[model samples]
Every structure is written in C-alpha cells, then in structure tokens.
Target chain A: MTIATFPPEPPPPPSWTRYLGFSTDAKVIGIQYIVTAFFFFLIGGLLAMVIRGELITPAADLVDRSVYNGIYTMHGTIMLFLFIFPVLNGLNNLLIPTMIGAPDMAFPRLNTAAFWLVPVFGTLLIASFFVPGGPATAGWWSYPPVSIQNPLGHLINGESMWILAVALSGISSIMGAVNFVTTILRMRAPGMGFFRMPVFCWTALAAQSLQLIGLPALTGGAVMLLMDLSFGTSFYRPEGGGDPVLYQHFFWFYSHPAVYVIILPVFGIFSELFPVYSRKPLFGYVYVAVASFIIVGLGLIVWVHHFFSSGVPQWMRDLFMATTMLIAVPTGVKVFAWLGTLWGGKLRLTTPMLFCIGGLVNFVFAGITGVMLATVPIDIHVSNTYFVVGHFHYVIYGAAVMGIFAAVYHWFPKFTGRMPYEGLGKLHCLLTFVGANLNFLPMHPLGLMGMPRRVSSYDPEFAFWNVIASLGAFLLGVSIIPFLLNMLSSWIRGPRATHNPWDAIGLEWLLPSPPPEDNFGEEVPTVISRPYGYGSGEPLVEHQAEIERRLQLQEAAA
Target chain B: MTSTTPLAGSAPASPEAAHGHANHNLTGFIIFLCSESVIFLAFFSGYAILRTSALDWLPPGVEGLEWRTPLVNTAVLISSSGTMVLAEQFKAREKLWLFRGFWLLTMAMGGYFLVGQAVEWSGLAFGFSSGTFGGTFYLLTGFHGLHVATGILLMAIMLVKSFIPGNYTGGEQGVQATSLFWHFVDVIWIILFLLLYVWR
Candidate 1:
C-alpha cells in the first residue's frame, strides 16, 4: 500500500466567508443555533405570560376564547419546536465534537444547512401569529377534525403555515441528527472508545438516534392533517370514513419518544455536571449510558399513555401502562446514580452546579408525577387537565430548561472567551428555581379540583391558585432578566477566562477558550485519558502527568 | 481497550483511508439515508394500515393505475440502482470518465421514472382531495418524486465536480453515499410498487 504523506503544516484557517456555508467547526454552528433558539424561547415565554394573565381571573378578561387558544397554542408550539429542541441541538453542536476531540462534524455543510433551517422555519411559525386568522387555534397537538375545521377556516392560513413550518423544522432536525450520529460514530479521537466517551455525548447520540427514527411519524401525520385541511381528504375525518383516532396514534408515536428526544440530552448534561461538581468519576458510567438507550427504546412503546382515555382496548391500555411504568425503573436508576456520583466528594457550588442540582430536585418531582400519570386510572382523570400541563412543564421546563441553563452557564466561558458574572448567575438560578415551582406546583391542585386546560375562563373557586400561578409566572420572567444581563455584560466587560476554568477534563477545555477557526493549533488532540478521570486528593498531579505524557508523544511523532 | 496505537510512527494511510478516516463524510450520508427511509417507511405503513382497514379491499372509484406501468417503473429503478453501483465502482477505481457516464445514465433513468410517475398520476381518476386512496397515493408517490428530484440534483453536482482535476480523487466516497441514497429511494419505490400496484 502507498503511504500518504502529511502536508508539512496544516493549512491556514479557512476564511470567515467560507465558514458561512459549510464550515465543519462545531462551535460556530452551535452559536448560530443557540442565539436563534434563545430568541424563540423569549417569544414562547411571552406567549405563556399572556395565557397566564388571561387565566388569572375567573372571567376571560385579557382575550377572547379564540385568541386565548392562539396564545396557548403558540406557546406550546414555540417551546417544543423552536426552543427546547434547538437548545439541545445547539448544545450538542457546540460540545459533542469538542468532547470527543474531533475537529468538526462529519459533514460540515450539512451541519450548516441544519442550523440555518431552524431560523427559517422559526420565522414562518412566528409570522403565522400576524397572519389573517392569527396563529393556530388548535392545541400544539394540532389534533385533526377540530384542527381541520377551524371556526375561521376560511380566513386562517395558520394551519397550512403550521404544517409547512413544522415540516421544515423536521427537516432541520433530521439533518442535525444525521450530523450528530455520524460525527460521534466516525470521528472520535483515538482511545476515545464508546464506553470512554463522556456521558453527555452518549446522551446526545441516543437523543439524535431517537430523532432519526421518531420524527418520520410526525412528518407523516403532519402531511395527512394538512391534506385533510387544504385538499379535503378524510385522513382524519370520520364523516368521510377516515379515523380521527389514527391521527392521535400517529402524532403521539412521534411525540412520545420526542419527549425523550428533548429530555435525554439534558440527562446527559446532568450526568456531566454531577461528576464534575462532585469531584469524582461518575459512579456507574455504563449504567448511565445503558439507561439512556433504554429510555430511547422504551420511549416508543408508551405513546398510548397520552391516550389512556381514547378508548384503546383494555389489553392494549394495560400493556401501555405497564411499559410506561417500567420507564420509571431506568429513570430511577439514573437518579440514584447521579446521587452516587455526588456522594462523598468535594462538591463545587457554582451557578451551573446549583442549576444542575435544582434540576435534580424539579425532575424528581416531575418523575414522581410522571409515574403517577402513567397509571391508567390516574391518567384518565388528569388526561386533559392542568395536572398534565403541570407534569409536562416540570419535565420540559424544570428538567430540560434548567439543564439548558446549566449548560449555558457551564460552557459560556468556552464560547465567549470570558467568564459569566457568578453573582448574577446564582441570583438567576435561585429565582428561576423558586419561580418555576411556584408557577407549576399549584396546578396539580387546580387540576385535582377539575380545572380543564386550554380554557379562557374557569370557575371562581379556581381563581386563587390561578392568581398565584400568574404571579409566579411574573417572577419567572423576572428571574430571566439576570441571566440576560449576565450574558451581555460578560461578553462586553468580564475578564478573559482561562482555557480550563473549572479544571474540567473534556477536550474542549484543552484548546483555547473560544477556540480558533480550526479549533486546534498545529496538533489535534489524541485522547490520553478518559473524561472525568479525576483522582481523589491528587487530581492535579495525575492530570499533569497525563498531559505531559501526551505532549511528549506528540513531540516525538512530530 | 487495546493499548496499541493505530497511527503511531506510521506515515498516514492512502488518500482513500485518509479521506475515510479523516473526513468520514459517508457516515453523515448513511445517517441521512436512515432518516429518509423512516419518513417513507411511515408513509408505507400508513398505506398498509388503510388498505387493511378498507371494507371493499381496493377502492372502487379509481382506475388505470395498473401494476404494469409501475412494474416498468420498478424495472427502470432497479436497473438504475445497478448503474449507480457501477458508477461507484468506476469512481473507486479512478475511472473518472466512465464513472461520469454511469452517473448520467442513472440520472436519465431516474428522470424517465419520475416522468412515468407523473403520467401515471395524471391518468388516475382520483385527486389528492378525493378520498383515502387519493390521500395515500399522492403522499407516497409525491414524496418519492421529491427524493428523485434531489437525487438528480446531487448526481448533476457530482457530474460537474468530476471535471475539476483535483476534486475527483476523494470524490468517490461521496459518490458512494449518493449511490446508497439512490438505492434507498429505489427500495422505497419497490415497497410502494408492491403495495399500491401488485397487491391490488
């Protein structure tokens, strides 16, 4: 075989204009996703505040029923599609290549395409709000029949826009998923075996795989629903011999695993944080990794849990309930493993660590409620109630949102070349923690008292809790102010951060903070030790030794 | 787990290995193909479910969409897949000119197959809005046509890129990815052809 010669020195970094189209540098693409997704997050949160304000009193004071429906609908749509998914995608885009010590994604152009598509679809979805009939009045589920037969059916182009935009978003996700999986599988640095890879990367890989398999059902459902609306097909119209329930089945099939698609990466985020803060290796690396895959596998079978009251057969319902309950086992294993990682170690109480710990508390409550909702009898009672809303917010907002906050604070230095204000971040964390629980915790009671979700008005008796929840919503909005300030101020005025601020072990920190265009200098990393290889009492010595050995090998080879 | 270093003290491997190891671009294509398959698979599954659910197995209204036309389309697609494989083989062997010819053949066959589908679509008595049969048929074939268009565009790009001297060497791996994608499109059509035409 002919031996290939290396180019004497690596070529100069590509121009900025070239980076715009197909740059393989993960950090740049990651920043693109993060900024766009955060913009949507603010829009989604504003929609939530509007919905809460309307429901603060017994009467529908703030908006009409249709307008109220639009608010809640846009809120859920933006949060799920534009906010949470993209945030995770952004995190993975930035960190996965670095964690695994790759120069960039396997396909650079595809990564650019994926990141850019988000803003396009996001603009389409947001613009629907200002269109003729306003944004979609149907819930985010966009269940057909009702969705197909809107009151302003003649005037509303919202449904078409919704489908087109969502389909576009789906395309973006599929591209990102492909890029993530391929990068992880084909581009890992030497010695970074699958088992040795960071848990965050493993979680991201699993989440992306779930996206790969799970999104097609939603795409199929969206197309059928669009046809039912525009083309007059009866894919979901029972009058035309089409079964509406089939739409539910198809929608939930994707949406259910999609819940994991949103949460699994956050789980990885926590997995990374716990060991780092606790100053120990993760207690059970394989357990956490295996649990991530198990969640993906089991996530598909439990979509019927969302529809326990949809008249599915008893045996099928029972099977779904059992599968749903079994999911708790893997989740519980992860919770305990995280606690084990935290036990008996030098715990760091930084803002990121605090947010991660707070995430644990909220997710515990969320998981408990998740198990409760899994029961067939309980789910039937709370199927369309505020309890369901509360349950999901806990998972999405409490677990996923807090996890995003943790990742932002943790990785802010590497991305910006400066450290975030610690005092402001801590303030943000505390206020957010209290605000999130106060906003969502009372809904369990309101749901138990028979308060239906998606209504413009409710009985006077539910007013007190509604008022409290609205107040909490305001507090939550206030809590984000500090975060925004910290982010902006840090970028402008904060001191430059060291490459390894936290003494972290990931390959990302081995390079300069805000890594150069090509990420590494003349040399690319070859993994010398496992991520989270912190030894007790003498971690500095061990890390130095490992670094020196790797540098010596590189020098000899050069 | 083994401590032996694969790249230690050795000159870099051949350009092919370097491209494969360093870039790993094919992995992204494989992953894309996997996702694209699921999208089509979902549509196919919907068709199967609807077919099984229909009272009078095949709907009575629509006609002229017989197995023969689609059968011919299927043959064209399968042959195109063979030509795609040939193109990849030639490109791998550094027969750049031959590779381009096979790609042109595949693209031409793909266009013919797409035109045949449009003709089949026009002859149908039903429209996308008509009923269940209309909905499923248009969706399955419409999405397949979209893939066919994308494949043609990709092939055209590869064909043009082949003429640039330095760009042709590591281009085979990318061609291989496009070939796999073409094969996936063909496989999906086979499933759709069996379900919509032959089974009926």
Candidate 2:
C-alpha cells in the first residue's frame, strides 16, 4: 500500500472558543459533549445525595414523600439519558475517526447538530424541576396510569416535560447512530479491514447499531404516551380501554438493549485498556470483537426479562428467562479475554489500568447478580427491591462509570496534549472503587431482607444497611472532587505529552498529540496490522517511513 | 472523475468522487429508514395486541372505519411509488423535464392522499378519544402521514433545485434520496392501509 508523501497542510491553532461555539470538528464536539455531560453528572449526583440523605434515617425527614419520588425519578432519568449516554457519545466522537484513520465523521455537520441537542434537552429536563408539580414522580420508566395522571391539571406539567425531553434526546441519538454507523462502515482507511480494527470501534459499531434498531421503539412509545397524556387518547390509559402493558412492551423493548448500549462501550474500554497496560496482544482478539455483536443480538431478545412481573404469561417469562441467561456466555467471553490478556504479562499498574481492573472485577460481580435477577422465581421475589438497584448500580456505576474514568485517564494525554497526574488519578480510582462497592454492596442484603426501592424511609432493621449505603454514597459523591481537580489541573498546567506516550499501537497514537483538524491530514494511513500489537515488531501502518516523517514534522513543530 | 456513474451525470466537478459521497449519504439514509420502520412496527404491534385482547376494540356506539376512501387513497399512494421510480429512470436517461414532471406528479398524488385522509376523518363518527381503535388508527396513520408530508417536502425541494441552471445537470443525490424516501412512504402506507381497513 502506498502512503502519499505529499506535504500536509498545517492545522489551525488550538483555541478554547471553538469548543464553546458550533464547531463541526469531531474533536471539538467530542470535548464539548464530555464537558457538558460532566455538568449534568454533578446534578444527577446531587440528586443521589439527596436521596441518600432521606434514606439515612428510618423516617422520611429530609424531604417530603412526593419530593423523594421526584428526586429519585430525576436521578435515574438524568444519569441514564443526560450523563451516561452523552458522555459515551462524546467518547465515540473522539475515538472513532482517530482509531479508524478517517479525516472526520461521515457527517460532520450532523455530528455538531447532535451535540447541540444535548443542551436543549438538558435545559428542558432541568426545567421540569421548576414546573408546578415538580419533576415526574412516576419513576424514570414513566409507566402509564401513574404517568397519565395529571394531578397538576396544567398543560406544561413535569411528566409531559420529561417525555418531551426524552423524545428530543432520542431524536438526537438516532441522528448520531446514523452518522456513526455510516462512518464506521465506509470511512476506514485503505487496508484497514474490519478484523484489523480496534475492539473499541467494534463495540461502538455494535452499540450504535443497537441505537438505530432499538431507540425508535422508545421514541414512538413516548409519542403515543404524550398523546394519551395530553390529547385525550388511550394508547396506555386503561380507563379508555388502552392496555398499560402495551406501553411496557414498547419501553422495555428498547430500554433493555439500551443497557447493553451503555455497557458495550465500557466493555470496549476494558478490552482496550487491559492490553495496553499488560503489554501484550489482546487475547482472542477476534473472539473479543465478535462477542460484541453476539451481545447485541442477545441483548434485543432479552428485553422481556424486565417484564417478568408485569403480568406476563408464564410461558413468556420462562422463554425470556432462558434468553436472558444466554447473554452471560458472550459477556463471559469478554471477561475471560481480559483476564487471559493480563495473564503472565508485564503488567503496568497505571491509574487507567487500575480503574480498568476495578471495573472488570465489578462487572463480573454484576454479571452474577444479573443472572440471579434473570431467573423468574428470584426476580419475582426481589422484583422491585433494592437488589435490583444494587445490581444495576454495580453495572452502571461500578462497571460503566469506572470504565469511563479509565478512558478519560488513558486518553487525557492524547486529547489534551498533557499527561494526567498519576497521583491524583490513583486516589480518584481508589475512592471510586471503594465508594462504589460500599454504596452498592449493602443493597444486596437489604434487598434480600425485603426492603423495597424508591422509598425515602425504611423499617428499623433495614436502617443499618441504609446508613452504611448512604455513607458510601457520600464517599462516591466526594470521589468526583479528585477527578475534576485532576482533569482541570492536568489540562491547564500538567507536563506536556508526546504522541504515543504509552507506546500504544492504534492509528490514533501514530499522529500528533490531539492530532489535527483533519485528523489524519490529507493522506490517511493504511493500517497494516491488528490492534493491541504490544511487543510485536510489525508496524501498524504500511509505510513506516511516512509515519516516521510525520512524527519528525510533529517533533519539529513542537 | 468518470462519467459512467448513472446519477453523477454531466458535471463540472468530479463525478467519480461524488458517486462515492452520494453512496454514503444514501446508505445512511436507508439505515435511517430502517429505524423509522421499527417505530411503525411498534405501533402496529400495539394495535394488534389491543385489537385481539381489548373488549371494546371498535367501542360501543361507533361503526368500523369505511374502506372506500382509504382504498382510493391507497391506490393513489401506490401509484405515486411507480411515478417516483419513473422520475429516477427519466433522470438517469438525461430527460430532465420528464424527471421533474413525474416527480411533481408523485408529490401531487401524495398530497391528494393526505386530503383524502382528512376528509375521511371528518366523515367518521370516531374521534381520537373514542377508544383504543381510534387511538391506534389515528396514531399509526397520522405517523405515516407525517412521513408522506416529509417526502413531499423533500420532493418539492428537489423539484425547485432542478430549475436552477447546472443544478440537476450533475444529477442531484437529493433526487435519489428523496425518491427512495417517497417509495418507502408509499410502502408503509400500503401496509398501514391493510392493517387499518382490511385486517378485521
């Protein structure tokens, strides 16, 4: 494969203002998404703290009952929609083009438009808090009858506002999924076949595919629900002969796959980080990549597991239980691949690696508990208990959020042209790991003891575990301090970073730190090797001399 | 830049490169349509479940929907798909006027279907709040109607762009995408018509 030896046009000077404006550059949009999502993460975290404060005692003293419902509802909604999804989209925007050797996304203007929808919907979601009836208290699922109840008797009530925000966000994500899938399918450099691409790209492909296939169901369901609530329709209103169970079918059909949509990228992060730190080729690289799609296929069918106790027939529940259990096989494949990669290798316990290991360990725990929750009998017993809460927090916070931290630390160098402070990063990881466990672990027993979820108060016996969980929740809240400080300080004045500082073997590492506006410049590199090629002397790009020339130019510029 | 690509047509810019760019756009648009189809599937499933299970499928007093108007509307929409195909064919043959003629006709047929639906709704005793049947019928058809309106809007834009000198001389990718969307809208209406009127 020939690499063009043409002189590259210099990228424009970096400026902070572009991140604040309507910059179509994927890198700028990526940072904008991450920073904006982080702001919402803080808000969601504050709501969690309020929930924790109310639960610290056996009495609902910290907030009123309705306020507690609103707080918990907003907590779930904001965490999933606002914080997790947007932050992951941010990562997708940043990593996809660079990893695949593309100049930019296939639809750059559409990418910027998708990023802008975040703040618009974010404002709408937050505005619900100021609305007359407070935020929607029907839980984030927003099931009907409860959701259709308009106690405020106003047109612009909180529930409608929540649905509007969610629908708008769904539209944004659909636009993003279309862009991501097209880019991944058509924009890879010459010689970079699908098999040769990094695991992260494969995972992003699978996740966005889930988005394209599953998100529309939720959006359509929301529209019907909106019509039922506002326009006197009965799509989900039982009083008008509309079945509420039908809404569950629509909601869980997407929301279940949506869990995979969140975790698959984190799984990609785990797959990415383990090999880099262990200084070895990724174990069963093909299997790891293929397992992602397997997860996606199984993910779509297992959505019925969420409806086990929603008056579904026994045959349906039994069938769904089997499908839900089948997901564990592919997940087990990924977990073992990470372990095998780490086996008998020169392990560098860097902060990113530490977070990856922590996240992986927690993921395994979540998987076991998930399997427990998958069984029809067990699920019915702890259907709406804190056990379900514990299981997902382990998945969402324990695995996904920790994995996000690892990615931020790992890519901080490449994105910001500076190395994150290892000291603060380790402290953040430690606090996060411990706090996450303390916060989520007690819920297992409290749930086994039959404590229900979404309640502000509990019985005296449940009070012990609740207090400990609240303490852990507070610690988890405090864990963000070191992380924010680390990011701000490192980006502002940390030691400057060199391209390929970690000696990573992806296409992104072959370019200058933060790359350029046209990520690969005019002549994108033709990848010649599989990723995670640690200790493999084979070059990743075909024309090694051209990459060396580009590096020399970068060094000279620096 | 080769001139052999069908849609690239005679252009000052490179046709070969534009062909690949246009393919990416079309592939993405098709993927988007696939997602859009799932939304219709959701509503269809909802309708099926309620029709089978609910006691008041047609409600107590209201009569079932009349088949005559929607049958005609369905014919109008299905013919619009054929016209859309002809529009693309004449564009490929470099007959710009025939392309615009068929394109505008296809849009006109779509517009007529909308008018027919409004008239049918006006005559029906059932309102949106009548029952589950009323909710599902209106939601499904109204959703499909929205797609039809969007397709017409897109076709109208393409038709306008064709009038500008040198615009469709290069053969607009928007023409192809718009026609694909129109055909998709037509197909969805066919399924929707059968489900709403003929199924019972």
* Model 2: pairs clashing at backbone N, Cα or C within 3 Å: none
- Alpha-carbon lDDT, every model: 0.82, 0.88
Residue A278 lDDT (model 1): 87
- Which digits, one per residue and each the tens of the lDDT, describe model 2 over residues A303-343? 88887999999999999999999999999999999999999
Could you give candidate 1's per-residue lDDT for residues B56-151 as a string of tens digits?
433566563677788888899889999988988887788878988999999999999999998988887777766677778788889989999998
Q: Report per-candidate DockQ.
A: 0.30, 0.41
Segments in model 2 whose C-alpha atoms lie over 4 Å from true places: A1-12, A549-553, B1-23, B169-171
Q: Give the C-alpha lDDT of model 1.
A: 0.82
**Residue lDDT tens for model 1, A1-558:** 122233464334333453245344567778768877888989999988899889889999888888888889889999999988888888998898778766667777777788888888898998898888888888999987778975555634887898898999999999889888988997776667888789999999999999998898899889888888877887787666577778888899899999999889899999988888888888888999989999988998999888889878899889999999999999899999999999997999999999999999999999999999999999898889999999999999888899999999999998777899999999999999999999999999999888999999889999999999999998999998999999989977897777778877677776666765444422445555556776643332224445544433433454
- C-alpha lDDT (0 to 100) for residue A36 of candidate 1: 75
